[model samples]
Target: MSAPKPSKRPIRSYVIRSGRLTDSQRRALDEHWQDYVIDYEPSALDWNALYPQQQPLTVEIGFGMGDSLLAMASAQSDCNFLGIEVHRPGVGKLMHGAHQAELTNLKLMCHDAVEVLEHCFEKESIDRVLVFFPDPWHKKRHHKRRIIQPAFVSLISSKLKTGACLHLATDWQPYAEHMLEVLEQEPTLINHCGPGKFWDEPERPATKFEQRGKRLGHGVWDLLFRKE
Candidate 1:
């Protein structure tokens, strides 16, 4: 008898919403993309080659409209920042913002973050990773599509250096709890906020999405875990 094959992992963590792009955003894609964008390939990226100096590398996943990411990168000149987002408009907007700010410490990838972690980032190459306000996928059946699963956390843990951090934020209570459960179960990660606790709001500026969520009375939760 033939051996059983391994089951294929799910490829999607988010569903792209249909939001029309402004002309400026589209124009940025054409004119400024080469300056700020990193083309995704199925090969490991060299962090030292990508930036001028060998400083700490931080990557933010799903940076919606990139307001907070732009602010953080602008404030932190010594550390290099890379962002991965599936939305073309967000990528273009961030590119434009980074260019306008004259920021040299930032780069971007327009692709699924999971694939990027699996292929483009070598093991223990990342110093810090951020996942802020990811889609909650609120429906019970769609919960499987949420990104904070054991396998996903494990993959992130593999890419983080020892003592490096993984920071996650969510406005949805259930998803935040789920994230806590998932991260705690990963033996390679230790909670910086203590076991089963959430962190205070991070120093980064708030994205438009987060601001809107806050205006509606939704509470936000942040989780910071270090690689053990």
Candidate 2:
């Protein structure tokens, strides 16, 4: 699972490219990805109507390359998966992984996750939310771009079912602390893991990037929060 670091990364146009959606993902999910998913915009998505079995749904946002998403879905087949990501290439890669795993109880959306939460889904519709290794936004000017801001946390909280879980992970210690601070302000969420939680790594497969991070002597953190 080792790959040479991608070389000569190009500055991509911020414009969304419709061509990036892979055919396999389309064939797998029966989803036709839109060029630009609107923010806080709702689409007609009904869980009960879509799947008669109506299994509990787990939503993962910013799944960098979807390595963990594929692994978790493989291990937990009984639960349905809903993935939201802003990057097109990553979404395309996730589609490939979902297809390769033959995952049926999975769906994907390429839109501002907040919009998905506000518009398409109903209250208590989601059972779990996972945000892993989001952009650190190290630069002071770009701090607003960090995903764990208080406002964003409030929106995410609105989408969860009672007793649902919200899990977050970051390799950056600063952002990890930021996540805890912002989440603490939200009265709706209660920290389920103790002070020892930040020190422990959850049981998960070694991703290509995580393995590399470990080789470089970096520590990864996991935070598991529950809805009160």
Candidate 3:
């Protein structure tokens, strides 16, 4: 008899870290989950029913600790924000903040962002997609685990509405170059800063990761691409 074949493990962009949750984060997760969190489903979400009123929708992938996302939601009351994060603590913190602020335009999902984007969101339905400070997966052999690849960029581009923007930011210079190369190859997107140039004047609020990187003297790169 032939030997049993080894099963292939799928490559994922993120690895869940065993970060301990604070008391408030735990409490929020247990009590306020239904108020601010959405259960992931394979079907496309109905935005009309999700938000209180019709507004431009922005989806943020991997909102670490929810600081930047919370700030954005609070600042941009006119836009609806949907944040996808796999970490439970981050979701809980964001929920706590949103509940405290009585925010009506913010929702969250604790799931794989790639699956969420591919299954829950309809093509040409999103106004903007933000991926800020994603894990670089720095090792050469682990480059396949990076999220900013050609296929993922194409997927993002397909989901964006015409004239909508896809904004990506990274502190790692090598990862930024990788992102630029992948994004430029996507036919559906046009770089807002012109070819092979990074966005010099970023209007988005600074993230906690960005601040930390800046203090360490790391250069940051922002790439803004618009869907055609």
Top candidate (TM-score): 3
Point out where model 1 deviates above 4 Å: 1-9
Return the candidate ranking by lDDT, descending.
3, 1, 2
Give the per-residue lDDT of model 3 (tens digit) for 41-116.
Answer: 9889887689897999999999988899999999999999999999888888899899899999999999999899
Tell me how many clashing residue pairs each candidate has.
0, 1, 0
lDDT, candidate 2, at 156: 80
Tens digit of per-residue lDDT, candidate 1, span 148-190: 8999999999999999999999999999999999999999999
TM-score of each model, in listed order = 0.94, 0.78, 0.97
The RMSD of every model to the true structure, in order and in angstroms, is 3.0, 9.4, 1.2
Candidate 3 ranges beyond 4 A from true positions: 1-6
Q: Kindly list the per-residue Cα lDDT of model 2 for residues 36-110, writing each as its tens digit.
A: 122334664776555435789898887666788888888988888877776766676777776667677767777
- The CA lDDT at 157 in model 2 is 83
lDDT of candidate model 1 versus the reference: 0.91
lDDT of each: 0.91, 0.72, 0.93
Q: Is candidate 2 or candidate 3 better by TM-score?
A: 3
